[model samples]
Target: MAQHETSGFRSFIFSRSGMVLLGFLAVAGYFLWEEHAAHILGYLPLLLILGLCVGMHFFMHGSHGGDHGSHRDEPREDDR
Candidate 1:
């Protein structure tokens, strides 16, 4: 007969103590979010604007081919 082996972390999480710890973390996170809800909502607009600016800065740049000088050296369709 062969015995199966489990990792220490995996075994602990499947045990009772890990379940209690996970429950405690869930309750704590719920209360923390409840208490700070107003503060987080107050910054929502600013966060959205900042995210838009950063997204546009990164995404819009890709519209142009990255080669700045090489295009000038390539023959134009008119030349062909």
Candidate 2:
């Protein structure tokens, strides 16, 4: 039998910045579609959401806190 070692899967989701850009792209696409169809821009909520995403991306992930290295000192419960 083969011995197992480390467990659990790492998250591969976008690390804040990628998600923000994704939101911006989606909203931009929607706006372009609306403009192409000669319709009113009715997706204001999407714009607000994109703004919030951008803010969070800059504040949460664009600084030293985004680095996962600072959390190394904290002892994990599994260590006990």
Write down the worst ten-residue block by lDDT for model 1: 62-71
Q: How far is candidate 1 from the true structure (C-alpha RMSD, Å)?
A: 5.6
Per-prediction TM-score: 0.70, 0.31
Regions of model 2 farther than 4 Å from truth:
1-13, 38-80
Clash pairs, model 2 backbone: none
Superposing every Cα of model 2 onto the true structure, what RMSD results?
20.9
lDDT of 2 by residue, 6-25 (tens): 43322222557667777988
Best by lDDT: 1
Clashes of each: 0, 0
